[model samples]
Target: MSEPEELPQREQRESTKKKKKTKRSGKKKKEQREGEEQVEFEQEVQSVSECVVLHGIFKLGKKSHDVLLTRTKLTWTPIIPENPTGETGVPQSGEVLLQDIFAVKVKRRRAAGQESGGPVLGVALFWCRRKGRRLEEDTLHLHNASSEHTHTWYNTLKELLTGFSNRPTNLKVFINPSSHKKEAVHIYRDHVAPLFKMADIRTDITVTERKGHVLSVIKECKLDEYDGVVCVGGDGSVAELCHALVLRAQLDADSPEKPVRATLPLGIIPAGSTDVVSCSVHGVRDPVTAALHIVLGHLQQVDMCSFSSHGQLVCFGFSAMFGFGGRSLARAEKKRWMPSSRRREYALVKTLARLRPEDCQLSFLSARKSNSNLFVQRDKDQDQDQDPKSEGEESWVTNQGLYLSISIMSIPCLSPHAPQGLAPNTSLANGSAALIAVGNTSRSEFIKHLKRYSSSTGQFNFSFVETHAVSAVKIRPCSLIGCSEDESEEEGDLKTTPFIHAEGTTFPWNIDGELVEIANEVLIRVHPRLITLYGEEVEEAESSVSCSCI
Candidate 1:
């Protein structure tokens, strides 16, 4: 049965070859027709010439292929050993997209028992490709015919990658191994570093030894050497890096002491407990997503809130809070011994157990007289000079109330806990913050407001909660001697605000995620577009009027 089938198969092959010879003329006419019908871009590309040709092994495979470099891509065709003197067996095994190639470099392997390397020429390429909806990366290692061939290939590819501004060629990376979940280093190794390699970015990485270590290093860094700085940690780490850049710029400016905006854009890879900054910027806490944004050179401007107390600069923060938000963070700090997964829940439970309203004085100046007249008066104000007026001419609204929470956010403040953001309508670089003030309310209602953050339709659904867009705010604690030390903490009993027995009482200020030391009166001002970050543009919808308690 095998012999009979084999004989017919040979006859079929012969008949197919004869048919190919007869149809050769028709095939050429068909090819011409197809070419004429092709897109204009394809017809234009046909005139481009092949740039380079080299023999190399690709992607760690043993067999070598004849690689052809064209203007737009590198195509590899397998060498048919059996038909060496005949036509190539395979048309084209694969092709590498030149635009996707992030890095190209020459490499060498050392000889056995010798200090010197061999005469073999090798090249490595890192490139990205889309797999379904996600971007994937791979490195192709190839052996060129000679050292000159390897150099020529590397130089040509390098030139192309350099021309693409989307890829960052050099970076200073700060990895905090002790951030929230303490997984920054691992995340960088697993997800971020490979992408950088693919993009051919040179990185100087520093695993911070202690808190504020990155700040000190950035202060003394040669700013001209690196393209940007990357923070591989939580919001606190990103904030610290931003602060360093701001301070460095201020020191270099003509007015050394004045607050200066950060010129060097920041790239954040989320690896902490609650990566509010990263989540808000990238819409996710995934490290690879942030890394891709950096490689692609995506830029977004964000405001920074400068805190001043007693006419002295306290610190800079993307977000600030002094009420329940601050209290929950302060409470979370004491439970450091608890497992990370359980720590936040335990702290929230503990803080809620002792929840109460605090009496405070809040004063703020609106950037706009009213939201209704925002765009209507913009051109008129810019066209005419303002009339000179005394400082008293500026209107500031003041309110005294028993408040559950007061949070001022410069960014959207998006996180897993609050996808709509702590302040849902907050703009990223609008030169204002979303100031949310919650009046004294029952515990159940306050909990409901908190729950609304996790939902899209009703974040500010309570009458007790109010949100306003403001440029500046002054907060002063009204009741200083609210609770004593023992009275503040009892099993299942909680205190409203942090108490101090000193001359003036101080309450914890939650700046970003890290808790600040106690302070009495704090003034916060939002600087417009103060810092640039490698982030995608955020489409924010003002949802302040979207929903109300029913």
Candidate 2:
């Protein structure tokens, strides 16, 4: 009886072992089926989402690749050869976004000394790649021996590029030969022209001969023929072009007082000493980047200020400065024989040495408070004390003081000197401008304030510094006799008279890096989204300042 019981126990143990093995095998089979289903589903989804535009085998480097083109991207997978053991290596793929591709051309091999005739080899793709804050040109060669194949790909790519409606097909380019270091022509020829040609953009280039040459040309030229205007120079050239464009637009609309929006966009290639406009707009003073922005159709609508004196329009500009800034620029203009950088430095030093406050009456219409942190935050107590009336009152805020420098900026005015911009609390287009007033302060304190612009914060933290979001501003400079007795004592005796003009008592003004002398009060009114420029909205600038003078 005991032997029979032991045999049944052994058989029961065997039965249990077999059932466990069967269960394990079923699980493995289920996993295999699920993996197969997953692959099938992925393939179906890919097929549904992407419509293959073209597929072919081309050589990338030494290896052949299976190239596939879709509406969104172009992908290439390396084709590995099978070994003698009937095993193939894993394929690696590379891809580029369709939008990144700017141009496609048929690669060719020509005989020595031959300029035009050549045999088609493959297709070459020219694309823009973002490297840090700049856009750089990159090229990829897809080698194929058939001319027909390459031409077909090229035509398809050309058609696709043409579909980008915002991209300019024709551009009117102006290069200021007298710009910083006189390299504008070289910059345009070497760096800018190739990119435009690659994108099949037709450009009518004009190398400016003298001051206001571009303005003269723009005034007479037919603007409708070109998609946009490109200026290759410094802040001054850009400012001039902006003024011309706005003036042209107003003339076209037959309403000089009621200005209209610019019809075409403006592109800036920085080749000047201080490319504040370019740096402010593109966040980098790079010609290649500017060209790429134009090619990619990046547009930024910018606010402009119409400077009017006694009801007559003085000019249209993005930024202007009075007092120290204007004096420095005026001195720099007198020393035209010196290098651009050295002249500016010398002028800065001289101006700082003789820094004197300009007694002026400032009045402005404040912008309504908003949630945007870009605007300067005013002290609640100060705001209430300055204006006791209700918030609904449209009365202008008035302030009278001896200011070292008064700046009104529609753009941030980014440059090597000021990384965050001279007016940090400003935007490209927000229907307002930043009005910054620096009350008379010690030279050391003023230099500290200027140096703070290169830092991340605290540029306007000092008690002497006042910043406001304003829709309009009026600046009226007063003679020395107009200053109060206490204010005059506080400011000390003036070293040099502010009135410099030989013909009349004219005050120097720096408008977008260009010096202008004006007599009497000037009214600056903000025009929102007045002109479209070829750049993306710059949210922040790279914190880097090259100037160490401050």
Quote each prediction's TM-score: 0.71, 0.83
The residue-by-residue lDDT of candidate 2 on 175-217, one tens digit each, is 9998988999999999999899988899998989988897799
The Cα RMSD in angstroms, rounded to one decimal, for candidate 2 relative to the true structure is 12.4
What's the C-alpha lDDT at position 549 in model 1? 25
Off by over 4 Å in 1: 1-100, 105-125, 129-135, 138-156, 369-393, 480-503, 538-550
lDDT minimum window of 10 residues, candidate 2:
380-389
The prediction achieving the highest lDDT against the true structure is: 2
Question: Model 1's lDDT to the true fold?
Answer: 0.74
- Under the 3 Å rule for N, CA and C atoms, how many clashes does model 1 have? 1
Instruction: Compose the digit string of candidate 1's lDDT tens values, residues 1-550.
Output: 8999899899999999999987997899898888777865576666454445344444337676778786678888766577667755654488887776766767776667876666655798877665422345667888765787788788877776666664577999999998876788889999999878766689999999998798799888897898888999988888888888887888888655456778688999989877888877777666776887788787887888888888888778899887787887888899898876577777676666677676789988776433421222222122111211222756888998778789888788877666677776555766667788888776777778777776774767688877777778889886555565335555542435434345655787789889997557888887777788987644332222222221
